[model samples]
Target chain A: MTTNDFLPAAAPVARLIQALHKLPGVGAKTAQRLTYYLVRMPEEEARALAEAIIAVKEQIILCSLCQNLTEQDPCPICTDPTRDRTTICVLEEPLDVLAIERTRCYAGLYHVLHGVISPMNGIGAEELKIRELLMRLNGGTVQELVLATNPNLEGEATAMYIHRLVSPLVPKITRLARGLPVGGDLEYADLITLTRAFQGRQAL
Target chain B: MTKPRTINTEAIVLRAAELGEADRLLTLLTPAHGKLHATARGVRKTTSKLGGHLDLLTRSALTLSYGNQGTGLATVTGAEALDSFMSLKADLRALSKALYLGELADTFHPLEAPNPPAYTSFLEALQALESPADHDLVLRSFELRLLDLCGFLPQLARCVQCEEPVLPGGHFLSPAAGGVLCPACKPSYGDALPISVDALKVVRYLAANSLSSSLLVNVRLPLHRELAALMSSLLRYTLERELRSTAFLRAIAQQWPKAEDVPSRTA
Candidate 1:
């Protein structure tokens, strides 16, 4: 349907609809639905939501050490004494750090590059936090550098570039293994992923 | 209601951007379609079958269905990799160069138009990059050939201004004038950059020969620098903007040592 059909006649309501529509995955219908929902919500609850958005925008800052978004300079993860300071897992974004943490598998520090090397988008290694990561490595306390960049082409390129640069300094460097996802059918796995899985296969 | 139209074509993934969650907006270059913007639904999810085949710089056979009616965007129904250029992607230097070539092709090619020759040239260039051939020569040849295909080929043998045949000692290249300038014409063009005779000969050779034959002409580091500078200037002038990949390629060059020279071909 057209914008006129979905957007409220009121200027403020229409404006809210347009703003909500700009959010990723929000269509005109979804935006209208959310806008109307907000309009019906209790004033206190709506105020809380607005205030939370403001708090996030104003209070959050990139962690000085890991470059992940945090309320503090060196985030809790970076300052955590339980973390293995000798190993650092490099990732493309802060969301990735959360994903890895969900597994409760590793206990190492993380350095978020904030983005991968994507030349098509005009983003290069310089646009990333690679320099900061290198500076952290130069402290000479880190013994292992785990490249946890995505399995995509841009991610691979970023990882390779970092590996080339940091190989000499770090005692060990490793890449996250690529393969079929857990619970995914073998027949559904893509050829590249399957190939990598076979290449990285381990014996029981 | 009319049935949806579907066409299967071989396409190279020129660029990809994230669309609403679990989907991707891809800019593809096809021999028949030239350039296309298609939505690959669910391509971002872990289970997407299209994800591996539709990566940037990959040539894949794609089945596209135009069913969104007014959107003018096609949805990818099926995809299989034709050539992933795995060897090229394995090396950071080669991968950067290949992406640069893909960007150039995307820039020169227009959407929804057929450009089989340009498409073929691009595919061949990627294949050449995947091989152990000279990276510099492959790039130069691709640039020259693509410019020729797009009718932007710079004048190398003759002066762009005086129309006199260029003498083989030293000349100036004016990207604005769209080619090399003879000694007499050099004074007229203030933007003309000095070009060595060796660099001129190499460019001319690359422009004339196929990618394989072009690789036979061994380019020393100094000459390669001259050629690269001249080509970069010409491209910047043509596009009226600097390509993003150029800086990345330059950074890659500075980080990695140059590959050893290949032996000059005898025939």
Candidate 2:
């Protein structure tokens, strides 16, 4: 039996529970817990959370240049002068841009495709931001294109498709190296990962 | 209360979709259990042990556990890759064909029903795709085999209408009637497609031989197109909807050079 079978919540409370249940990982019980918590929360805090959500929806827009979510036209990364303008790292989502930025290892621009090419899901190259990426390379300023899509099958297919289309435009095209995880044990490594690590071995 | 049953089986990762934040819902095809929909928790995380093994189109050995009287979705507890088909995944054209095969197998085979022949045909097709053989021929042979296994094989030996022997001449294949219609019966079936004598012969040959034997028969461009269209029509009729991968296969086929045009290499 569900929580509602025990006691019927108020219309507003039930409505809130239904809305929360639509989220990615929230289930019926979790939604009810959140709903009851909201009922007990102070008005000021609840209003603040609601207003923050609205602000995010209203103010944020895709950056015209790199297609990353940003408040301004060209994101700060695209306009940053200290960053190398000769290289661009192509990624599958905006979150990936933040992941790479956290590393602080590479200083280059980024392009977000927003998704990978998955035929099973009815997603093709045309569905992604590929045409925009090609247009970005037409200026002839970029020299290296790094494909940082995930190492899964769909990601690899997307990278291959983009590489075939953009190879003539960019002088150097490279894909992210696949290997064993940093903290994982070598004995636990899968064969594919081990083979790739061997083939992509670096010289000391 | 009895404990949940744990079963180990070899499976092909046919389709996968995101579940919660870090989980993946996979559609796997197995020889013993047919198709299974299971959820792999934390598979999207970088440190996941099951992530690399459960990629789409990869065949792997899986350990699945069922609870609540086996009505709920199975949970994947362990996974190890058997054949990743690396070469096929590296080439876009071949990858498209392999995915189509996976989708076709997923469509024809029902869940919880043991179908070893269907499963074996799909595995063989994936293996054949990794070789330097003709990819289209492999697909044609797989389609015929799958259609036969599913009891949807088009009547090539005789006319579907009158049940008479199909003579050696131009005939029409009727997807609606589920077979070829002789010229005398073609006017009765409006949905029939014109099939040349050679095309009929090729289709018959594919149905009669194994996938490896089918690869030995070299087909020119026109006959290849005819067989593709005929098989596509039969599949569309059987499934009642065009598969998403069909369009991708056609789009990529147009971009690549014809198989006949590429000179064969001899040792």
Candidate 3:
């Protein structure tokens, strides 16, 4: 067939665009742009990108204890000796462990639930890494659970769900905090803060 | 040392945000109090002891030292969990719903109030969620009961304008006017949306009982729709706008298979 006759009828490109659009926060236009970008990328770069996708599925295994995606069956965080054995910080995703670590804070080990409890969305407590978390606590070395889920709705709910389930098993459970962002301005604060500011008023 | 306030109450973790370099703040829903904010000092530290005990959705018996701060904040002294709700985190659908409810609770309930009934209602809702039996009904019951506690009861048993006993028939829910309207009263109500008789039955049933009761498990789709409609109307009436989480809830509910019917592929 001639090159003109064999010209791509947008189907292959359209499929790529559709796939990109399905990703979190990627709109259709951005997906289209990304698809076009990929189509023009160097052959080596394209091969590398494709290989990376294959590699994740090929190499990534869940940490046996925490259920987090890891190259090793027992992730480095779970295996590290210096990490606290008496406490575990439960998170919704593996990336959250990274977020806490970025702050240069937290020496305790981690457990990734992979998700949170959400009844309206049809998720319950049984689908998470909670059973494994409980099992880890059974040894009695773990004394506390720190819920490091996101600050949003699902994050808070997941933390509470874990707390309720583990309260009887673990002696201590705690959550993250909220406040005015560092360097944030008073003029930009919303009612939640305006209320906090009023409630935490200072005496003249 | 003074004895810390050792209280036993079921709490919903509402929100968590980072504080100072090594501290975290939490909003909790207590069984004896509506909502409260507590501080976990040094919780962000590498060696902080309170880290795991402070996450969201964890129901715990807390030992709090009521801080004398001008803000009336409670400092978490000790914590022990009662249930982990592990099932919720494993499934995406359940996870989304739990988060949506947490958002709703955080939005509607005030932070400082000694509202024991509100606390109990929330606990019952969470427990109902721990299993697969009638989750939709549990949520609907919780919403209706919450509105009732907040002084926004739906006019389920009778017509809004005529005051006549509402019978099974074509009905419309008017959020602006507040409650359902019979066929005769629909036009006069100005903005009533269509509702089925079954929905009204569910609404009335939910409105009549405590959320913890078994009556919730009896609800089916028709009743589910009705309770949802009624709650939508009531919340719109009270808040004067729609909650952002309502859309998410609707989206998730659409993904759920019809009652007693599994997806063909799964089956």
Candidate 4:
């Protein structure tokens, strides 16, 4: 499977590098290095990488309400009737929703922002799916919005952005309680602490 | 996809995602780098030796084989436990806060990027969580510092628009524009929050001072409140979105009896 034996230097390996380099944060040097490595990789390993990429594209879709990636439209978390509906814990990414679920402390709905607000980065409110979140609040079923974005500058900005936008639309909008490390995410909290947070939820 | 580079570091296991039946996709934050994801083959099976050291927020030293061969994620070579925020496990509020911090750290820090300042800040925050110093202040300070380290520290020294210094006393922070604004400058932005002088001071303290310095030794509630307000505004301004963790934190705070509601510790 070595590239030396597989094809000319100008073949698919070159094409793959070009493609990989376009991804966020992947430098061209990294892309080329990876493409060369993949050239030498075993056939099965190469297929696996291709498969994972395809699997996400083919199988994953936004959970209807939470907008998180899921094979299902509503996602497991959103469909579970056992979960609390009045409170929706809002987060920045799909991974965050998963992180919270792992704790088993939260049995409520969620809303994923996909990205936080960064003015310097030129990401504004319109860039995010916040307006969609406001639509969720309009139904009047949700009573609280638990802002679970990360605790960084962007995370804080994103949370405050949503609070001002959604607070007027919803009955309550509360930020995550502050004992957690600042500039951190909600996805990494342990089960016991997450459980306590779930049990202790208060009105905004 | 680049060839995954083999790397070694001391890390804290933030969480594990079950992949298929035997493998686990592990998320970790290291002292050298920041947040990263790696696959641990067959670690979910009973015979796997890395189980104890790989739980949520458990610190460990790990060697990883680059993910270049497949999956672009790292594969764990070995792991050894350092110390666990075990107490956080028993206390729900504490644990939630820890997760919030860990998640924030994981999100902000990138894999394979060296962020010693972030690493140290996270380490100190976790340690502080164990002891329970004014948790709010600690969290706010950590946030302020993290933003500073990330180079997004909110501009407390001057107004975002006018470039004039933000005078002490009641001012406003414009989330739409990004940073504090003087009274004259406030009307230019629509979505600004009224920030008190105390809050501005806390913001300055958080943005200007280092955690290793004499900041946290003596924190006042007024400062905490101000920080909370400033942080809320600054973060909202910066991220341009809301965090679920902030809401969760506020929710938990509400359930706990006020200091006045609870009897004095010595009495």
Candidate 5:
């Protein structure tokens, strides 16, 4: 039975349950369990949780430069002087920006498109933050654009499309290398992956 | 609780939406089930084996098990790509039109309904799109044929107003009124667009003939515009929503003028 079937949980508790269930992957059972857990939690801890949610809602905004969510308009990364400014890495989502940041190798600025082009899903170039990326190129400061979209059909298509649109404005454009996985067997690789791996083979 | 049943079917990926963190919600158009929406667990992860086969516009044989949790969502257990439509994927313009056709099929075809005619229409439309040809003409023919197959064929054979036989001449096409109107009924629907006899004839021909024969038929620039306008109006009335791909296609058409600027068809 659904958590709602528990006969109209107290208004506040029911609201909290609904809010929890709205989060991704949180089903009815998990929502009810979490609500009860919160009820049992110390008053200070629960207040801290509510306060953290409120703070995030109040403080978080997209950085004016990279479009990444942050408390400040310019964000810490955008204000950092140690990062390379000559190159910019473009990605489909803010999550990708985080993924790349975790690698700790790349030190360039980033431009988040917020989404890739997917015609089947009715998402197009107009829907993305591509114009913001283009506007960042106006100063003739950034020399290279590293397209880091996923290695799938929609991602490839999006990269290619942005490349065409921005090629005239930039000096060089590069794409994330596509090849076979590190631990995968060659025998099991699909035709497209195998072909890309073969075509992109590097010399020792 | 007893586990839900699992079944297999051949299908094409019409749309894929990200779900949870690593899974995808796939809208698959199938022959037996019409339009199906299922969750492919872990598909967004690179390590997932089913990722490649479930991409948008790719056809695959899918094994799906109904969710016993009463979520009304099925889980894709396994899948294999049957047709990749590689060339269409490579070209931007072709890809746009192909995806437009997919969106149209998804919109016009209802969920959980087994409509073989609409299903086969989709199959043939994708096949027709795979070949190199006039992308717009191919799309128009696909739209008209899909409309015909879906039983939304506008009453073109006669006056939709009075059911009078329309002669092979000038007539008005009305979206709200549903089809071609004679001069007598034309004045009533002021919004009715003028449709030349030749344009209506070509549209009828495209709808009735096989994709190959439709490709062979030559439509002059003027006739082509009329046909395109008529079909677009018919589609807007039937679906009542704008096709998303049209904007992207319009952008490309504006950039590459000659390829999209329709004149007369060769042969």
Candidate 6:
């Protein structure tokens, strides 16, 4: 939704600019600049961009099992039997799956919560994929559930809540180990993370 | 060329929602500025220095530069976290209450309106919750004070319609009428919740007394129910809408039953 009627140029170009403005981080001026740039583009690139956006809207469906955005029903990872079916690493967003996948840390399946329970922003557990995750857990094949939500208040709250909801029904539930990031200055670290690192210290 | 207006305030991060690809829209409740929404650019990226200091429930001193036009969302140029309340990190119950306090403040206070009273109450409330104080009392006191400050202080001792003093016994609370109603006038309102005199006294005590002092009032379980119901209806009547945080908080309350036994630091 256009907030406070920010854009009012009335042309199709203005509509494009407003649409871009609605997106996160794109300021009004930047939105206009991008729109004008897109108008000047040699037709195929612009058509391709438009079609790609349309294709995502028309083709992408939430994976029935994991709730990750994909073109297929169960998504590739959920359908793969070779993957470690023993664990399910839960995340706050589809992007988080990519972030963890890049680390090549584990071969477990994934569950995307889509959003955290943040009431200040009107998000709740009912609005997320927690119920689907619970249904997935009911199959009993999953043993270890890793809560890998972002290290923020809402993320932590979501993790705690789901942990409460799923702990009784499952064998074990785990959270990503908190510690100092590599190459980080210890002095600059926030007290919370630093303290967590100390509390969960490891033997070298 | 004239420079744009810049505002500086010490504020707590009430809430943070994603604004754009890599930015956040923050609701900051400040002593002088009340609750203001500012845009922290590039905050979603780990490289963004401003991101860490703006975590939920963190209080920080901020310098916001209203962009050239001196309109729309202000840009957060500088931030220094005064306190991160790290104690709340592990305790999920405390975290929920802390978040509730933030959302409660955000809900009642208006944008850019200076409400030092509400701001002070909010900061104190956060500190109390972070202390893992009796959340029920903390929340009740905060709600009472918030109502008093926002000009929604419900009348306690008198009847809304008859203008007679309500005796110290079970009475009807007419939120629409903005106070307690004596039995004589109870039939005048379509919406009235039964509230005990003890509950009214507690609300009056909370309204008249400072939050820290009001926390000392030991409300029994039955009175607890009465006070909560009365205040919620009062809040809904005054705010004209249900506060979303209360529901979220209730969910957390159900999750952690032992939250009631959480030791108060002051106690």
Top-lDDT candidate index: 2
Report lDDT (Cα) of residue B225, candidate 1: 81
lDDT for model 6 comes to 0.81
Per-residue alpha-carbon lDDT of candidate 3 for residues B84-172, written as tens digits (9 for 90 to 100): 45455434445555666676677678766767777777766776777776777777777777778777775766788788787777878
Ranking by DockQ: 1, 2, 6, 5, 3, 4
Off by over 4 Å in 6: A1-15, A18-21, B1-8, B63-74, B260-267
How close is chain A of candidate 6 to the true chain A, as a TM-score? Answer: 0.94
**B105-219 per-residue lDDT for model 6 (tens digits):** 8877888888998888887887787663566788899988888898888788788788888887768989888888888788889899888767777888888988789888888
- Positional deviation of B221 in candidate 1, in angstroms? 1.5
Q: Write the per-residue lDDT of candidate 5 for residues B67-157, one digit (tens) a residue.
A: 5553478899888777877667766666667778888888888787878777777777778776756666787888888878778888888
> Can you give the DockQ of every candidate in the order shown?
0.41, 0.40, 0.03, 0.03, 0.27, 0.33
Better of 3 and 5 by TM-score: 5
* Residue-wise C-alpha lDDT for candidate 4, range A43-71, written one tens digit per residue: 99999999999999998888778888889
* Fraction of real interface contacts that model 2 preserves: 0.38
TM-score of each: 0.91, 0.93, 0.54, 0.53, 0.90, 0.88
Runs in model 4 lying further than 4 Å from the true structure? A1-204, B1-5, B67-71, B212-223, B258-267
Between prediction 1 and prediction 2, the one with superior lDDT is: 2
Using TM-score as the yardstick, the better of models 1 and 6 is 1
Encode model 1's per-residue lDDT on B124-172: one tens digit a residue: 9999887888888899999999898889988888899988888877689
* Candidate 3 residue-wise lDDT, A23-68, digit = tens: 7657666877898999999999999999999999999999898888
lDDT of 5 by residue, A48-105 (tens): 9999999999999999899998888898998899999989998888889889999998
Which of the predicted structures, 1 or 3, would earn the higher DockQ when compared with the native? Answer: 1
Pick the winner on lDDT between candidates 3 and 6. 6
TM-score of chain B of 3: 0.82
True contacts kept of each: 0.47, 0.38, 0.03, 0.00, 0.26, 0.34
Chain B TM-score for each model? 0.92, 0.93, 0.82, 0.85, 0.91, 0.91
lDDT tens digits by residue: candidate 4, B158-251: 9888899877776887767667888888888888888887677766776677665524556677666766776777676676676645554554
